[model samples]
Target: MQAFIGASLLSSSAAQPKRKPFEIYDRRLQGFTLRVQSTGVRSYYARFGRNRRVVLGKVGTLAPEEARERCQKVLGHFAHGRHPLHGIGGTDAITLGMFIADTYTTWVKASRPRTAANTLEKLHRLFRTWYPEPLTAITLERIESWKARRLNAGRSAATVLRDLFTLSSVLRRAVTVGELTENPVRRVDKPRIDRRGKVRFLDQAEESRLRDALKARDEEMQKLRTAANERRQKRHKELLPRLTHFGDHLTPALLLSMNTGLRRGEVLKLRWACVDFDRRLLTVEGRNAKNRQTRHVPLNEEAMSALQRWREQSGSRRRLFDVATGFRTAWEKLLKRATITRFRWHDLRHHFASRLVQHGVPLNTVRDLLGHSSVAMSLRYAHLAPDQRREAVAKLNEKPLLALTMRLQWDGFPAGSHYRIDSMVEREGLEPSTPAL
Candidate 1:
């Protein structure tokens, strides 16, 4: 049908078809169209080329005149041999929130299941204001201004850098999928950070206190379990198992991490099949590993003992630990009981690496044991192994054989007496050569 698409025609139900959908072509513009669905839903559209069509927006959301202006812009682009939706993936009207909700979220969830929730939440919280804005509207200047604000608000440079990185990743994905021509974040200067900052680990005194706390906790839990079982027996109920060996998974879990340097995720996701008692090795599956590569960590006596005790206690469960949620609450409680300050669960891994380095383990070996991708990461612990440097410097203090012989020849001379070189040479049972002069 050919007619002028006006506001009154759009608002009136007379133009809406009850049986089938229909399009009303604009009399003013050649390819402008208004599509009215059978259910009476109406939207504006622009038709270009042979069979191309672009839905501008719903009739109520965009007025006929406003849709007409947008349609003209799209048609003008098409006439100039340019893609009507060039920068955007398919539609010029896609906003940041729309793109994230409709596209990026699905891709990220599939590719990065472990961090998808946190990453998506951070994106939503940090860029909520930008949700209504189009992707192209996120310019370098705007990002720079945001970064400045965050810094001025007492956020650390490292944190601001991380935020920028996350934002840039989203924009980079847009560019990769043709939703954007370029990533403006590429032009923004990232905040500087010192990568080699001091690493936190437990000292001897703190480690001792932590061990004492663990032992105390286990004893207390065992007493409670005994009391509970006794009460159950008195009530004629099924007797729960007694607490033997370690109190719970927490003690063994901490020991394993401290010995093997496994990440918290890897430790939580560990399975009985991955542990090899005979080979004294624990395998981090590729799926659980951050780098997506399987790595075998050699289990020392402590790690092996922890795993063995845990297996005996946990029974035939497929996974080693039954912790569905993280250990944040339990960990904080344990740290408080131990009276250890400025330490984190991740510091257990650092403690393992630091101990190995202090014991004169090679940096390359430390890198492999820690599952670091490169030796450079393990270099942070290099200061712990100063014995080789000390030995090298100690060599400078040893007297040479020639110097020892020269000193012995002058040993009998009086204090502060000057000895001739020729006399000294002769005294040392050697021929004195004549000087050229």
Candidate 2:
């Protein structure tokens, strides 16, 4: 049985009932010594080993009841012929090699989106440092020390934290499955990303700049297509159905990704059936999505027209593009033509969101449309929310406001200034100005 001690703000060792600090009275074989000592803290640690002093928790970290409970638990383990401090040796001392492999396999089957594989790659790279020992033998101190060492070696804290989380999560699962007794990865904090990975997407002006560029390119491509067709006609059946000149092929694909907001992978895998021309909707099933959830997008007239033209060009209700291998090859050529050297295909998705925001779509609406799991994940588009509000203001058709102003100036408020035209000015707080309608 364990004893209880009262707690206080002025609480110290003097206020407690004690035989001695960590007093251990031996009643077992070999020998045992119990004494409370400081374990890098002010809390009392009840140690119970002859040579190796085992640390319990802090004095106040656990309440008197909890301390007693833990003591009884340790005592129970001892009663069962197990060591009270460390281990009774039931854990199978699996090599890190075997453990990591098992973890990777479990993750591949149960978790995905490539994060699982990426995590295993890090653990594999770090395996030489922390393998071959009993997993339970790996303590918090050891892991923290390794993390510090990695940080000192100029590795990133976020990377270290992520790697540790992956490895530690697997070991924790092992403990749950009765393979280990403790988790070493809990309470580890991840490194904070700088600027939260900020990137300035196209604002209204930049968007206009790009659209103007695309228009110019479209005019150029039309001329190029005309020339290519003329050359094909002159050559007269010398080839395989007269492929489009590179310019025509590229501009449209760029236009499609930017206009439709489909992910690169989703765009590449887009099928003819996904587009509902009648409803002006593109149904992207969940299986093809990054999160394995389906998404649908209502096509604007422009996007639908592009799809229609693509369908006609490609000859059916399936994939729009026939050279469906890699869009990147075409993207590189297009970006070169457009003089955009630094952007990525993923940037098109950002561009899409930025456009909607500029045109006044709410962030929540965009989040739902994009299938973000949380608003926090969707907050990257918050900068767009302000633009949405701005867009709503812009949409009031200020020319109508101007027209109203002109009408009031010429006709003297059009018989009444207030919306309720017959109401008294003093009663309605009305003025001789253009009335709100």
Best model per lDDT: 1
Candidate 1 — which residues are off by over 4 angstroms?
1-42, 45-55, 58-92, 389-437
- Candidate 1 lDDT by residue in tens digits, 223-317: 99999999999999998776787788889999999999989999999999999999999999999998888999999898888888878877989
Q: Rate the local accuracy (lDDT) of all candidates.
A: 0.83, 0.60
Per-candidate RMSD, Å = 7.7, 16.6
What's model 2's lDDT at 125? 78
Q: Write the per-residue lDDT of candidate 2 for residues 195-242, one digit (tens) a residue.
A: 335655665565566666766766776676677777877889443332
What candidate 2 gets wrong by more than 4 Å, as runs, is 1-92, 110-119, 126-133, 142-165, 194-197, 203-238, 244-252, 317-325, 387-437
Predicted structure 1: lDDT? 0.83
TM-score of 2: 0.56
